[model samples]
Target: MKFRRWCRNCNCEQEVAPIMGYEDSWRKLFWLLEFLRTEETIAEATFDEYMEHLMFFGKLAFDADDEIEKRLKEEEVSDND
Candidate 1:
């Protein structure tokens, strides 16, 4: 599925972008998408892989913000324990 957030350069929130598909790719794609938002650079190979996944996954955009938030919180709690 895809996700979106505020984009400073565009001065508006972008349309949801499908970054990845499948359970396995979703986790890493979340972080990579965030990095792109902050104007961070990823390796060429990784970028190619993400784009390939995007095409292969077909059109599926989901607001995974809440899921990401929950996972992060769970990780924090486990870390403290």
Candidate 2:
């Protein structure tokens, strides 16, 4: 059985074990980026902050996505049985 982390905000599936280490940071970063891209607001400081958070969680997010997919598959199998 495999476990994974799921990011509800981005619907990203990560393969790594769940860790709250940078969840908040990533969430804020994602929000900021979305706001900038959608609102066309130029907030340099916010952009910088968003990048910093992305750097911290970029790798984690990838891994977590994989794990999440694996877990979901397992759950489906269990439910079928």
Q: Go through the candidates in order and give each one's C-alpha lDDT.
A: 0.56, 0.57
Question: Candidate 2: deviation at residue 14, Å?
Answer: 31
Q: Which model scores highest in TM-score? A: 2
Which lDDT tens digits does candidate 2 get at residues 1-81?
333544548957655423333356466456444444333344434657657656656667667778999999999999999
**Number of the top candidate by lDDT?**
2
What is the lDDT, from 0 to 100, of the residue 31 in candidate 2?
Answer: 49
Residues 1-81, candidate 1, lDDT per residue (tens digit)? 556556647757665545344355555556455545445343333667667745443333344555787899999999999
What candidate 2 gets wrong by more than 4 Å, as runs, is 1-56
List residue ranges in candidate 1 displaced over 4 A: 1-62
